[model samples]
Target chain A: MSVLLDPFAYSFMVRGFWVATLIGVTCGLLSCFVILKGWSLLGDALSHAVVPGVVVSHLMAWPLVVGAFISGMLAAVGIGGLRKLSGLKGDTSIGIMFTAFFAVGMLLISAFPSMLSLTTILFGNLLGIAPHDALQLLVISLFCIGVIALRWKDLLLFTFDEQQTIGQGLSVRGLQLLMLALIALVAVAALQAVGAILVMAMLITPGATAFLLTRRFPAMLLYAALLGGGLAFGGVYLSYFLDVSAGGVVVLLQFIVFFPILLCSPRGMGWLCSARGGVR
Target chain B: MRTPSLRGLALTANNGSIAVDIQHLSVGYSNGVIALDDVSAQLPSGAICAVLGANGGGKSTLCKALMGIQRPHRGSVRLFGGAVNRMLKRNTIAYVPQSDDIDWDFPVSVQDVVMMGRQGQMNWLRIPSRDDKRRVAQSLERVGMQAVARRQIGELSGGQKKRVFIARALAQHARLMLLDEPFTGVDMTTENDLLDILREERNAGTTIMVVTHNLSSVPDYSDQVMMLNRRVIACGPTAHTFTATHLGNTFGGVVNELLKVTGAVAGEGNVAMSRSQLPEYPQ
Candidate 1:
C-alpha cells in the first residue's frame, strides 16, 4: 500500500499526474473531431511544427506556449494555403509544411547548441515541469475543452456534412478555421505533457479507440475522455514504480489499451463472429 | 451596375412569387474553367423545378450557388425577394446534397442527423428543444424511417440514406428545398415514393428545385424545367421547354444516342416518354 502511495507523496509527481490527466482529457475530446474530420496528419503536422517556435521562444525569452501556438497555427494556415493555391493534395501540403518547420527547428538548435535541448522538446520533461508551465497547461486545457463543449454540435455538423452546414447558413470556413485553431491550441498545451514527438499519438489514439467501441458520437466522446484520463493516471502511477519515462509510458499505455479494444470491440474484428453468428 | 429603375422593375417582376431568382450568374473555377455562364432563371413558389443537364453541365454548381457554397463571379441570387444568405439564415432554405458528398462512415444517428435540420432554430449552443425532437420524429415518420432513427447513419442502405436526408430537409420546415440527385441509386418504387413526397411538399407550398441528370422522370413530375449546359438552354413551363431540341442542346451528343436507343421520336410534343421505355442517360 505504501509503495502504491509513494508517488503521491512527491509534489512534482502530483503536479505531473494532474497535468497529464488534464491534457489527456482535452486531447481526447478534440480527438473525436480530429478523427472524424480525417485530420490525423494535420495533428501530426501541428505538433512537429511547434519545434522551431519553442527554439525561437527560448532564444528571445517569449512565452513558450504563445510561440508554439503561433507556430502551429502558421503551419496549419500554410498547409491550407498551399493546398488551395498549388492544388496539391492534403497530405502533400501537410508533409511539406511540417517538415520545413521541423527542419528549421533542427537547424536553429544546431546553430545555437547551448540554447535549447532537443531531447527535452522531443520527449517532454513532465517531472521537471515548472509551476508556471503547469498553470499554462491547465488554462489551455480548460479553454480548449470549453470551446469544444460549447460548439460541439456545429463542429459535428460541419464535419459530417459540410454542404448542409453551409446551406443552413453556418460558416463552413469559420468552423474549419476553428478546428485548425483548436488543434493548434491542443498541440501547444500537449507539448508540455508529451512533447512534440508523441503529441499526435495522444490526440489520435483515444478517439480512434472510442470510435471502435461505439456507434454513437456522443457515447464515443464520453468513452474517449474516460479512457484518456484513466490511461494518463495509470501511466503516471506505473511510471513512478517502473522508473520509465512518464510521457513514453503514457503513449505506450494508450496503445496497450487500443489494441485489445481493436480486437474485441463490436466495430472491429470481433464483428466477424458476432455478425456470422447472428446470420446463422 | 443596373440603374435604379431597372432594379425596381426586376424587383416587382419577381415580387413575392419567386422562390429562386438568379440573374446573369456566372461562376468559374480557379483553373479558368467556367462552371456556369450567364445563367438566369426565376422559379415561382409552390412549384417543382427540375434542373436537367449532363455531367459537368453546371447542375451541381447551380445548387451550390443557390446554397451560397459556390460564389458566383458575377450577378446575384435572391430567394423569396431577399438575399440568398439572408433567407438561409432565416431557416427558410434546406439542401439535400448528393450522397457521395457525405461521410457515410460518420458515427451519427439518423435522429441526430435529422436534428441538424433544426440547428438554425436552436440556441447558440445548439441544444435541441422538445419541439425540435418532435419535428425530427415527425420528419422521420414522414419518410417511413422512424424505426431506424436510433441506428447509426452508416448502418442504413442507400435508399434509406436518401430518405434520411430528405427527412432532414423536411424537419427544417424550409420554404425552399434543393435536392441534388435524389434518385440516383434508389429503386423504382422508392423513386416513385420520393416523387410523391415532393408532390406533397409542393402542395404544401414548398418550392423544390431538384438537380438530376435523369431525364425520363422530369416531364411527369416537374412543373418547371431548366435545361442547362453551362448556360440556360431553356427555362420555362415543362410543357413548353422540356422538348427534344432543348435536351439535345443540354446533353450534346448523348441525347442523340439516347433518342435512338429509346426509339422515341425527337419531334416536338413527343418527348414525354415512360421511364420503362427510356434508357438511363449515359453519365
Candidate 2:
C-alpha cells in the first residue's frame, strides 16, 4: 500500500498526474470529432507545426502557449489554402504544411542552439513541469472541453452530413473552422506533457478505442473520456514504479489497452472468433 | 382540394400559389463549365415537383440553388413569395441529401438523426426539449420506423436509411422538402412507400421537390414535372409535360431507347412499365 501511495507523496508526481489526466480528457473529447471527420492526420500536423511556434516564442520572449497556438492555427489555415488553391488532396496538403513548419523549427534551433532544447520540445519533460505551466494546461483543458460541450450537437451533425447541416441553416464552414481551432488549441495544451512527437497518439488512441466499443455517439464520447483519463492516470502511476518517461508510458498503455478491446469487444474483431465457432 | 391545416400559412393546398419561383437562374463552376443557364420555373404549393434530367443536367445545381448552398451568377429564387434565405432562416426548408452526402458508418442513432431536424428550434446548447422528443417520435412513427429509433444508423437497410431522413424532414415540420435522388438505392416496394409518404405530405400542404434520374415513377408521384437539361426544357402538369418530346430533349439520345422499350410514355400508363423494363440511362 505504501508503494502504491509513494508517488503521490512527491509534489512533482502529483502535478504530473493531474497534467497528464487533463491532457488525456481534453484530447480524448476532441479525438472523437477528429477521427469521425477523418482529420487524424490534421491532429498530427498541428502538433508538429507547433514546434516553430515554441522556438519563435523563446526568441521573442513571448508565452510559448500563444506562439504554439498561433503557429498551429497558421498551419491549419495554410493547409486549407493549399488544398483549395493547388487542388491537392487533403493528405498531401497536410504533409507539405507540417513538414515545412517542423523544418523551419529545426533551422531556427540550429541557428540559435542556445535558445531552446530540441529534446524537451520533441519529447516532453513532465516531471520537470513548472507550476505556471501546469496551471496553463488546466485552463486550456477546461476551455477546450467547455467549447466541445457547448457545440457538441452542431459538430456531430456537421461531421455526419456537411451538406445537410448547411441546408438546416447551420454554417458548416464556421463549424469546420471552429473544429480546426479546437484541434490547434488541444495540440498546444498537450504539447508540454506529451511533446509534439507523441501528441498525435494522445489525440487519436482514446477515441479510436472508444469507437470499437460502442454504437452510439454519446456512449462513444463517454467511453473515450473514461478510457483516456483512466489510462493516463494509470500510466502516470506505473511510470513512477517503472522509472520510465511518463508520456511514453501513457501512450504505450493506451495502445496496450486498445488492442485487447479491439480483439475482444463485441463491436471489434470478436465477431471473427465467434464466426470460427459458428456461434454468430 | 384538401383544406390547408392551421400549420399551413398563406400557402394553400393546390391553390396555385407558387411555392418555388426560379427566375433566370444560372450557376457556373470555376472551371468554365456551366452547370445551369437561364433556368426558370414555378412550382405550386402542396405538390410534388419532379425535376428530371440526365446527370449534369443541373438537377443538383437547382437543388443547391433552392437550398441557398450554391450562389447563382444571374437571377433569383424565391420560396413561398419570399427570399430563399429568409425561408431557410424560418426553418421552412428541409433537405434530404443523396446517399453519398452522409457518413453512414457514423455512430449515430436513428432518433438522434431525426432529432437533428429540430436543431433550429432548440436552445443554444441544442438541448432537446420534451416537445422535440415528442416530435421525433411522431415523425419516426409516421415513417413506420419507430421500432428502430434506437438502432445505430449504419445498422439500417438502404430503405430504412431513406425513411430515417424523411422522418427527419417530417420532424422539422418543413413547408418545403427537397430530396435529391431519394430513390437511388431503394427497392421497388420502398420506392412506392416513399412516394406514398410524399403524396401524404403534399396533401398536408407541404411542397416537395424530388430530383431524380429514375424516369419510371416520375408520373406516378409528381403532380408537376420540370424536365431540365441544364435549362428547363418543359415545365407543366405531369400529364401534359412529361411527353416523349420533352423527355427526348432532356435526356438526348437515351430517351429514344427508353421510349422504344416502354410505349407508355405519358400519363398514368407510364407506371405500366416495370422498373427493370426501362432501358438504363447513363447517370
Candidate 3:
C-alpha cells in the first residue's frame, strides 16, 4: 500500500496511470469492430507500419503521434489500393504489404543505433510517460469513443453483414474506410502504452474474449471495453509486482481469460473444439 | 394485380408492363469477360417471375443486374418510373439468397438478424424506436419465429433459417421481394408457407421475382415464368411457361432428373449450381 502510494505521489507515475487507462479503454472499445470483422491481423499490420514514422520523428525531434497517425493511415490506404489493383484477396494483400512495411520500420530502427527506448516501444514505458502523451491519448480516446457511440448500430451492421447493409443502400465501403481510419488512430494511441509487437493483442484479444460471452452488439462492445480495461489494469499491476514486462503479460492475461471461456463458452467452445455448439 | 399494401412498391404488376427495364446491359468480371451482352427486357410487375436458363445463360447475372449489385456495361434498370438511381425509392425491396451463402455458425440472434431491415426505415443517425420494435415483433409473429427471437440464427433448421430471412424482408415492409431461391433444403410445409406468404404479400400488393431450377413450384407459386438458356427462351403466364417444350429447352434432356438433384438452385454451398454443368457453348 505504501509503495503504491509512493508511485502515485510521483507526477510521472500519475501520468502513466492516465495514459495506460486511456489505452486500455480505447483499445478495448475499438477492438470489438476488429474482432467482429475477423480483422485482427489489421491491428498488427497498422502498428508495424507506424514504426518507420516513429523512427523518423525520433530523429527529427518531432512528435511521435503525428508520424504514427500519418504512417498508419497510409498503410491502410496502401493495403486497400494494392488489394484492389493487384487482384489479390484482402487478407493476403494486407498481410504482404503491412509485413513489408514492418520490415522497413525495423530496418529504420536498426540504422538508428542511438535511438531512445526501443524496448520501451515494445513493452511500453508507462513509468516515463510525459504529461503530453497522457493528455493526447485521453483526447484521442474520447474522440474515438464519441464517434463509436454515435454510430454504434450502423458500424455493427457493417461489420456483421456488410453485404446486406450494402444491399439496403448503406455505404458499406465508406463505413469500412472510416473504420480503417479510426483503427489507424487507435493503433497510434495504443502504441506507447503497449508497443508495436503487442499492440495488436490489445486491439483484438479483449474484443474476441468478450465476443464469446455476448450476443448483442452493444453488450459485446461494453464487455469488450471492460475486459480490455481489466486486462490492462490487471497486467500492469501484476507485472509491476512480479517484475516483468506489462505488455507481454497483458497479452498473456487476455489469452488466459479467453482460454477458459473458449473451453466453456457456448459459442467459443464449440468453435474451438470443432463441435457444432450453440452461439451465445 | 398486386395490392400496394404496407407502404411499399408493388411494381404495378397487372398489365405485363416492364417492372425491370434494361437496354444495352452488359456485366463482366474485372478480367473483362462479358456475362450479359446488351440484354434488353421488361418484366411486368406484381406477378411472381422466374429467370431460368442453362448454366451459362446468365440467369443469375440478370438477377444481380436488377438489384444494382452488378454494373451493366452499357444498360439501365428502371425499377418503377425511375432508373436504377431511384432504387433507393424501393426501400421495401427484399432479397433472399441461397442457404449456404450465410455462415450458420455466425453469432447472431434471430431477432438481431431481423432488426437489420429496420435500419433503412429509421432516419439517419437514429436508433430503432418503439414503432420499429413493434414492426420487428410483428414480423417475427408473421414468420412464426416469435418464440425463437432470442435464439441464435445458427441454431435454427434449414427451413427455419429461410423463414427467418423472409421475416426479415417482411420487417422491411418490402413491396418488391427478390428471392434468389427460397425453396432449397426446405421441407414441403416450409415451402408452402413461403409460397403462401408470397401470395399474401402479392394480394396485399407486393411484387416478387425468383430465380430457380425447381420446376414444380413454378405452376403453384409464380404467375409469370421466364425461361432462359443463356437467352430468354419463353416468358409468359404460368401455364405457357410450364410446357414440356420450355422445360426441355431450359434443362436439355435432364429436366426430370434435375428435379431430383435436390438443393441445386442458386447453390452457394451444398446447393449451388452454375454454368459449369452445361455443355460448352462455343465462344
Candidate 4:
C-alpha cells in the first residue's frame, strides 16, 4: 500500500499522473479514428515532424505549441498533397514525407545542440512536466473531449462514409481539416506525456485494443479511454517505483497489455474459436 | 452557363416533372482521361432509370456527378429545379455508392448506420432525436433488417450489407435516390426484395437511378434504360432503348456475339449471369 500511495504524495508525481491520464483519454479517443481511418502512419509522421518546430520556436521565443501545430499540420497536409499530386499511395507518401521531416528535425537538433535534450524530446521527460504544461494539456484535453462529444455522429458519418457525407451536404473537407488540426493539437498536448517517438502508441494502441474488446463504436471509445487511463496511470506508478523512464514504461505497458488482448479478445483470435464453436 | 439555362428551361418545359437534369456534363481524371463527356439527360419523377454499360462505361461517374460526389469539368446537374448542394441540404437526394467503396469494417451498428441518413435533416449539433430513431427503426423494418439492428455492420452478409445501405437511403426519405450496383453480390431473394422496395418507392413518386450491369433484368426492374459508353448511346423506355444496336455500341463488337450466345443459352436456361463473362470494352 505504501508503495502504491507513495508516488501520489510527491507533487511532480501527481502532476505527471494527471498529465498522463489526460493525454491517455485524448489519445485514446483519437486512436479509434486513427486506426479506423488507417492513419497510424500519419500520426507517427506528424508526431516526429513537430520536433524541429519545437526547437525553432524555443530559439525564437515563440510558443512551442504554435510552431509544433504548424509543423504537424504541414506534415499531414504535405502527405495528403503528395499522395494526390504524385498519385502515390498513402503509405508511400507517409514514408517519403515523415522521413524527410524527421531527418530535418535530426539535423536541426545536431546543429543547435542547445535546443532541449534529444532524449527528452524523443522520449518525453514526464517526471519533469511543469504545472503550466499540465494545465495546457487539461485545456486541450477538455476541448477535444467537448468537440467529440458534441459532434460525434457527424464525425462518425464523415469518417465511415465520406461520399455519403458529401451527398448529404455535410462539409467532409471541413471535417477532414478539423481532424488533421485535432491530431496536431493532440500530438502537441501529448508531447510531454509520451514524447514524439512513442506517442503513436498512445494515439493508436488504446483504440486498437478496445476495438478488439468491444463490438460497438461508443463502447469501443469508452473501453479505450478507461483502458488507456488505467494503464497509463499504472505505468506512471510503476516507473516511479522502478526508477525507470516513465514514457518508456507507459508505452511498453500499453503494448504488453495489447498482445494478450489481441489474442483473447472476442473480436480478435477468440472470434475464430467462437465461430468454430458455432457461437457468435 | 448556356447549358444550365437550357436545363432550367427543360425543367419548366417538362412541367416541373424532371427529377434529375444533367446538361453537357463532363468529368475527367488528372491523367487527362475523360470519364463522362458531354452527357446530357433529363429524367422524370416516379421513374426507375437503369444505367447499363460494360465496366468503365462511366455509369458510376454519372451517378457520382448527379450526387455531386464528383465535380464536373463542364456542365451542370440539377435535382428537382435546385442545385445539387441545396437539394441535398433539403434532404431531397440520397445516394448509395458502390458497396466496395464503403468501409465495412467500420465499428458501427446497423441501426447507427441507418441513423446517419437523418444527419442531413438534423440540427447543427446533429443529435439523433427520438423521431430519428423511430424513422431509422422503420427503415430497418422495411428492409427486413429490424431484428439485426443492433448487430455490428461487419457481421452482416453481403446482401445484408447492401440492404443496410438501402435502408439508410430509405431513412432519408429523399425525393431522388441514386444506387450504384446495389444488386451486386446480393442473393436472388434479396434482389427481388430490393426491387419490390424500389417499385414501392417509385409508386410513392420517388426518382430512382440504379447503376447496374445485369442487362437481362433491366426490362423487368427499370422503367427506363440509359445505355452508356463514356457518353449516351441510347436513352428511352426500357423495351425500346435496350436494343441490340445500343448494347453493341455500348460494349463493342463482342456484344453481337454475346447476343447470339444469349439466344442459344436462353432456351437451355442455365445462362451464366456473371459480369466477368461479359466482353471488356477498351477504355
Kindly report which residue stretches of model 3 are placed more than 4 angstroms away from their true locations once superposed: A1-7, A56-65, A110-123, A270-280, B1-13, B53-60, B89-92, B228-230, B256-283
Residue range B1-283, candidate 2, lDDT tens digits: 5322222323333377889999999999766789999998999888788899999899988988887889999999999999887778788788998877888778999999999999878899899999999999999998899899999888899999999999999999888999999999898888988888887888888999999888866756777788899989998777667666677788887777667766635334333233344555666
State the displacement of the C-alpha of residue B93, model 1, in Å, after optimal TM-score superposition.
1.9
Q: Write the residue-wise lDDT of candidate 1 on A1-280 in tens digits.
A: 6877999999999999999999999999999999999999999999999888888988999878788888888998899999989888899999999999999988998999999788888888888899988998899889988999899999999988887887777888899999988898888777777888999998999999999988899998998998888898889989999999999999999999999888777777776547554310
After superposing candidate 2, which stretches have Cα over 4 Å from the reference? A275-280, B1-14, B261-283
Docking class of 2: medium
Highest DockQ against the true fold, candidate: 4
Task: Give per-candidate clash totals.
Answer: 0, 0, 13, 0
The stretch of ten residues in a row with the least summed lDDT in candidate 3 chain B is B2-11
Query: Model 4 over residues B1-283: C-alpha lDDT tens digits?
Result: 3332233233323433878888898999777789989998887777888888878889878877876778899999998899987787777778887788888767898988898899878888987788988999899999999999998888999899999999999998989898988887889899999989997887777888988876646656676778888998877655456556677777776676765665522222223223333343332
lDDT of 1 at A264: 74
Could you tell me how far off, in angstroms, the CA of residue B139 lies in candidate 2 after the best superposition?
Answer: 0.8
Best by lDDT: 1
Best-to-worst DockQ order: 4, 1, 2, 3
Compute DockQ for each candidate against the true complex. Answer: 0.62, 0.55, 0.40, 0.64
Best by TM-score: 1
DockQ for candidate 2, C-alpha atoms = 0.55
How do the residues A72-177 of candidate 2 rate in per-residue lDDT, one tens digit apiece? Answer: 9899999999987887789999999999999999899989999888888888888888898889888889999999989999999888887668667788879998
Model 4 interface CAPRI class: medium
Model 4 chain A TM-score equals: 0.94
Q: Output the better candidate (2/4) by lDDT.
A: 2
Q: Per-residue alpha-carbon lDDT of model 3 for A75-134, expressed as tens digits?
A: 888998898788888889889988887777778778887895668666677666677767
